[model samples]
Structures are given as structure tokens and as C-alpha cells.
Target: MAATPNIYGILAEFETPADAMHAAEKVRDTGFRKWDVFTPYPVHGMDKAMGLKNSKVGWFSFIGGVTGYTSGMVMIWWMNAVDYPIPIGGKPMFSPFGAFPPCYELTILLGAFGALFGMLFMNRLPRLHHPLLKHRRFALATHDRYFIVIETTDPKYSENETRKLLESVGSKRIELVEE
Candidate 1:
């Protein structure tokens, strides 16, 4: 007999955001790390229910802004003081005031880039497809449904136990999603 196909995860459909939020809380309490909740609209407190922490994207933007500002200052200092120094009206070759505008512009530019790239990296985005996207019922998630998916790769995942947990949390339908 052919072996069963690899499973991506267990998908549990829920009828309401409250139901999905409660399911997420239960799953979080169960200590399953590789799981997510989906809903048609943003649900307040879902992040707390999912046990998520504050995002690190701000750090990325801060680092990028610092780098940009430093580079801008260094470039201005080098160009004015070292590359082709010309004493004009006894003015300083490099002035922070003179560099401030360009440095600020660069900081904003690089900070925006950092936020964009960090979000993409953190989300693992630019993907052409996902197995969940192919699941027939998953399309309803954008319309009027809520979903909770626990990945098979999660250390706490056990087919029978996970299914039971989801059922206990009031999932309307439960199915295994194949990889």
C-alpha cells in the first residue's frame, strides 16, 4: 500500500471570532507553538490569546536609520573636509547643520526600507503559494469564517489529541491539511 501523503497541519473551522479566539487561547494554553488563527476581520485581544509578543520591526527600523544617518554624516564630512577641501569665507568644512537635511532624509528613507523588508522577512512572504490557499474551505476565511490551524510540525501536535482539543473548543469542522 502507498504511504499516506505528508500532512501540513490540522485545520479547524470556527463560526465566529469569539469561537476562534477561545480556541486560540486553548491552543496557547496547550503550548502548541506552530499554530495561527484567521478571521475575516481583526479581532481585539487575539494577539494576547495567541500569546504573541510585541514585534521587533521597530528595532530593524532603528538600526537602519542609525546606519543611514551615520553614513550620511560620514559622506558629507569626507566630501567637504577630506576629498576636496576648499576654505571659503573661513567656514568650517563639515557642519552638522549643513548635513542635517540630507542625513534626516536618508534616515527616513532607510527606516522605511527596513520596515518593509523586516515585515516581509518576519512573515516569510513573497511566497507564490501556500497549502492552505489550496484548501477548498479556507477561502471562506476571507468571507465570513474563522479558522485555527495547528501545524503537524508543532512538537505538541498529536493527531488524535489535537483533533480532540479542537473539537472540545467548539470547532465546527476539523480536517487534516495535506502538504
Candidate 2:
């Protein structure tokens, strides 16, 4: 039989999100990357334990909002003043003041789209092929269970050592999930 190329991951189960959080803090302080926690609900202080930084999704949204506003203004400017110039119901040509509402709405639309898409793209979401999928116990994530997983790509990972590490942090159940 041929051996499957493994996508190595470690799953550590905890009885409570609090325990999971403590373990997460220990792991994060160890400077481990490529790790994630799964919980039935959001755990307060979990982000800090996971060492997450402020998201830059808003920055992307801001840029998109600016772009959309500029685009709207430029389009209005070109249509009213330069390209095929026409008066609107005896209104002034190139009436930028009249374009404010639609331009602002479009700015908001673009900003929301940019934020949503930017987060999904940056996080590489919809991960359908994760190694953790192979773990039978992971299904409890959506229920009342809590888990922490670390990828084997980390330089410090080893089979026995990884198991020992999770155990040291008081993980009740430890699994080496492979893809």
C-alpha cells in the first residue's frame, strides 16, 4: 500500500472554552503559528489569547469607498460637463451637489463589498480540504465542544512532542489529524 502525503494537524479537545483559552494562551506565548481554535460560540478574550491583531479589512473598505466616490464624481463630471454635455431639467451642468446622495450610497456599497471580499480572500475561507476534516471528533465544533488545532508545518512540530505539548496544556483529548 502507498502512503498518503499527510497534511499534518493536531487537534486538542477541551472541556470548556476557558480551558481552551488558557491552552491557547500558552501556545500563543510559545510563538506557535498555523493554529486555530474552534468553539460553539465566540469566547471573550480568545482573540487576545490567540494573538490576533486588528483587522485591516476596514482599510480596504475605505479605499474602495474612496474609489467608488471618485468614480461616481468623475462619471458625473464627464457626462455633465465634458462628454455629450447636457442640461438636466434646466439644472446646472456638472452639478456635483446633486450627485452627493447616489455617490455616497455607492461609496458605502463598494466599501461593504470590499470589506467582505477582502476578509474572505485574506483568510482563505471556505477551506474544503483541511486535514482536520479527517478527524471524526471535529464535528462537535458546531455543537458544544471546543478545540485547538496546530498545523505540522511549524518547525517545532513532531509527533510525540506535539502530543506531549497538548497534554502539557491539559487537553483532555488529543488527535493527530492527517489529510
Candidate 3:
């Protein structure tokens, strides 16, 4: 008996951005969660067609910025007022105006870090390998072609049905990608 190959997904290639966008819409309508689209350039309205929501990176950045600002203020207060009282020129020991510069700088720094880390986490990036990377046709995605990959792990995936769906969407080429 022959061992069955591990199927990764179904890959559909499109001739143009419009075709790929339309295919994405159909896939989205079919309610497949484990799917993604690739294109040579950014496709306007692709997010909507894919039913994607706003990124969570902004929330991460906001939280980081708030934490940074608060920590900066607290650190300055601790050092100036609590740890050692330096009464210079009758100036207040702890002042918001004085802390604003360092607080603002920390806020920017932490916010940027949050955005970078958040993006990497959300994308599951730094991946060492992917089945699609080995596919010869997939490389064209960076050059001229657009491709849509519907993972077999998706709840709605049915080999026959998914292939038919791709055909209906006018895919130029369809292949079963294996792991």
C-alpha cells in the first residue's frame, strides 16, 4: 500500500488582480477561514473582499504608549521627589512639564516596539518554511501572477467542491499543494 501524501491546500492562480479579487470574494462568501491571497502589488479593496477586520496592532501600540508615559512619569517622581528631594531654584520637586519630554520620548519608543512585535505576532512570521514556498508557480506571485490558497484544514474544505469553486471563479490554473 502506498502512503497518502499530506495535502496542504488548494492553490488557484489568476491572470489579473481583478480575477484574484473576485475569487477571494467567492471564497469569503463560502466561509473558508484558512485561506489567503497573494499578489504582485497591493490590491485595493482586497481586505474587504477577504472579510478581514481592522488590525490589532493599534491597540498594542496604544497600550505600550500609555504604559511608557506612566512609567516615565512615575520614575521621574520617584527619583526627584521620593528618593532624593532636589530643591533647585525653588522649582517643584516633581512637575508634569519637566517630565513631559522624557515621557513623550518613551511613549514613542515603546509604541514603535509594540507595533513591530504586534505585527510579527499577528502574522505568525519568521516562519522557516511553508508548503507554498516550494511551489514553483507561487514564485510568480511576486512578479506578475496573483494566487489564492485555501487550506485543507479549513472547516468547509472538500477537495472536489473546492476545485469546482476555483473553476467557477475562473482560475487560470488550480493545483493541490502537498505538505
Candidate 4:
């Protein structure tokens, strides 16, 4: 339950993002599904190069923002106009303008929350471990290395075949990332 996935395939490290990108695309071209790449910084055009889909988190953020706006507006309106019927400074019972600040803040809060949760859900995060973490050199990934993980779930994944595949794709240094 703690370990996220039984990553039993192979891992290949790259000295640069370009190499990682190249290897990832070639690996994908060969029909490998259970694979992911790690990078220290966002690499320009990496998404397209890796054949990744646009994130759906935007939709979640949109919905969350709408919800937050609605919640803030309704709460303020009800409290001032209908719930308590308080009349302050001769202003209108429901001050739509007054609600703007809180509504905006709420929208941002909700949007951030939605994005965070959406990412976690999309990525299946919060697990205790990953296969890449087991690799001794994988620690360098966060510092200066780019890495690709090919998991065992892929039909094309086999120790020998995966090794050959990585080697064929011009992997700089191949290592078995364990978990």
C-alpha cells in the first residue's frame, strides 16, 4: 500500500534534458506505456516531445473558481440582505461591489486547491515510495540529471528488451531504478 507501483522495469538517466526528451520519444514510439520522465526544471516543448496530453487540472480549477465565487457571493448576500437584514451606512442590503474582494480571494483559494488536488489525483500521489527513489543515482535527478522510468507494467518491458531499447535510444547511462 505504501509503495506506489511495483516498478520492475528499467531506468535510464540522461545528462541533459535533450537526451531525456529524445529517449522518451523513441521509447514511446516503440509502444511503451508505463514510462515517465523526471526533470529538474521545466524543459521547453517537453510535453509535445513526450507525447503528453494537456493537463485536465485547468477544468477543475475553473469549476472550483466558479464554486468559490458563487459561495462567497451567496454567503455575503444572504448574511447582509436576507439572513440578518442588517442596514449599515445606508448602503444596499446586498452590496455586490463589497463582495468582490472576498469573492476574488475565494476564487483564487479554490482554484489553487483544485489544482493541487487535481494534480494529486491525476498523478496518484501521496504514496510513500516510488521506484525511482530507490535508485542510488536518482538523487542526482533533482540536482542536475534528467531521468526516464520504464515500468514493468508495459507489455514491451522486459529486463533484456528494455535494456536494449534504452541503449538503442541513446541513453547516456542506464541504471535499474528500484523500489
Candidate 5:
């Protein structure tokens, strides 16, 4: 017998955002974690349905901001006090008040960079292609369809059972996505 084809996942198409959201809740309750939902437009409460937690991007930004501020302050102090020992009209060479503007600017710059890079990293973006992109009907996802995909990598995934689950959850159409 020939070997079975490798598959990326099972794709279920829903007629409406509510149907997709409800199916997501079912999928979550069924304990299948390796899944994603795609919609033509944003759906409120979808994150809760997908069981996702708060993002760590903010933490990345905070760390970047702190590093920038510390580095800015240290560089200013080292240049003014340790390196040149500048004495300007009896003013302290390394006063923090004098360094606040540059420090704040650096903090904002690095924090913005952190947020941008962190978002891209977290989303695994810059991808050129995905298996789902080959699905003929998937192009409609940007117009009017909503899709839910459950990857075969999920521990709970079984072809027959996943198909049945999607059917029971009111999927209008279901198609297998090959890798």
C-alpha cells in the first residue's frame, strides 16, 4: 500500500463569525490546543475562546526601555565625569537632571523598537507561504468566510474524531490541508 500523505491540519469553514467563535469554544473545551481561527474581520472575545493568555510584548518593551535608560545615563556620566571631568560653571558633571532628556528619548526609541521586533517574533511573521495558503477556498477568508484549523500535531487530534467534532460544531464545510 502507498504511504498516507502528510497533512498540516483540518480546516473547517463557518458561515458567520458567531459560528466560528462557538466552534472555537468547543475546540478549546475539547482540549485541542494546536489550533487557530481565521476571520474576514476582527471578532471580539476570540482570544478568550482560543484560551490565549496576556501577551509578553509589554515585558519586552519594558526591558528595552530600562536598558536604554540605564545605558544613556551611564554613557552621559562616563563621558562627562569619568572621561573628561567637565566642570561647567560649578555644575555637577554627571547630574541626572541634566541627563533626563537624552535618557527619556533613548527609552522611547528602544521601547518602540522592542515592541516592533517583539510583535514580529511572537507572531512568527515574515513567512512567505503556509500550507493553508494552497487551499482554494481559503482566499475567501479575507472577504466573507471564517476558518478554524486544528493541526495534526495536537495530542488529541485524530482524523476521524476531528472531522466528526467539526461536523458536530456546525461547520458548513471541512477540508483536509496537506503539508
Candidate 6:
């Protein structure tokens, strides 16, 4: 059989956050969509440079909160009034007012769950492996280096053109990361 192709992407290393940020902006402007930047620390303008939009995790939390509140209210009403109708201490079988506290608690509970799970799912967490993890020099991402990866999967990706683009953006080191 022919040799298997193992290319994953082009990984560009920059000497500083500013270089990475500038490279990100150039990548974004060049219409390459499926790329990412990794830095040892959060870079202030990286999100803007990458043209990333705000995350939708809050929407997931909101939906979970609403569902939890509605479910709590309905459960209370059903158990106290419709199902058992137990009157206690001259109180009404189902007091909408009394249900508010539990509903609020459940709302908070599920909202927390939603936010946690939403973030995990959105970020594709619990990942066991990534191609970048195998790159010999990529470990510096957690310490002192910044990286920009132009994925081969991106629509505009061309190996030679991407290498040239990375060089044009002042990347001092560029490597072809393999899957």
C-alpha cells in the first residue's frame, strides 16, 4: 500500500503574544475559518483578533433554569393539590407562594448544571487526545510560547500557501503537525 498521509495542520509559533495576535488577525482577514490560537497566558485582544463571537453558554443556562423552575412548580402543584390534596395547618392545598422558594432553588441548581455542562460540551472537553499534544514543541504552549494552527480542514487551507501566510505574518517557526 502507499504511505499513509498523516498531516493534521500547520502550526505557527510566534515569539510574543503580540505576534500571535497579529497572526490571528491576518488569518482571520485571509478568510480562514477553522483555525485556533494557543498562548501561555490569555492575550487581551486575541478574541477580537480571531473574530470570535460571544459564546452561547448563557442561553443553555437560561433554558435549564426555566425548565427547572417550571418543573418544580408543576411538581408542587400536582403533589399538593391534584394528586394528594393534603391541607396542613389551615393552609391551602397548593400555595403558589410557597412553591416559589423550591422553584427558585431548583432553578439555580439546574442553571448551574447547564452552565457547567454547556461549557464542557461547547469546548469539547474531557478530550483524551489531540494531534497538537503529540507535537514535540507544542508543550511550550503551557509555559512560554504562543501558537496558531491553521487546520488542514479549513476550506482555504493549502499547505504551501499556509506556510507562506504564516511566514508573512512574522511567524519565526512553522511546523507541519501530523495527525
Tens digits of per-residue lDDT, candidate 2, 47-91, equal 999999988888889998998899999988887788887766988
Evaluation by lDDT, superior candidate among 2 and 6: 6
Question: RMSD of model 6, in Å?
Answer: 1.5
Error of 6 at 50 (Å): 0.5
Better by TM-score, candidate 3 or 1:
3
Instruction: Write candidate 5's Cα lDDT for 1-179 as tens digits.
Output: 97887999999999999999999999999999889999988899999998888999998899989999999999999999999897999998889999999999999999998899999999898899999999899998999999999999999999999999999999979999988
Estimate the TM-score of every prediction: 0.95, 0.92, 0.96, 0.85, 0.93, 0.94
lDDT of each: 0.94, 0.87, 0.95, 0.84, 0.94, 0.94
Better of 4 and 5 by TM-score: 5
lDDT of 3 by residue, 67-156 (tens): 899999999999999999899999999999999999999999999988998889898987999999999989999999999999999999
**Candidate 1 per-residue C-alpha lDDT over 54-157 given as tens digits, one digit per residue, 9 for 90 to 100:** 99999889998998999999999999999988887999998999899999999998999889998898999999989899899999999999999999999999
Sort by TM-score, best first: 3, 1, 6, 5, 2, 4
Error of 1 at 6 (Å): 0.9
Q: Which stretches of candidate 1 lie above 4 Å from their native place?
A: 1-3, 86-89
Model 5 segments more than 4 A misplaced: 1-4
- Model 5 compared with the native: what TM-score? 0.93
Candidate 5's clash total is 0
* TM-score preference between candidates 1 and 4, better one: 1
Q: Against the hidden true structure, what lDDT does model 2 obtain?
A: 0.87
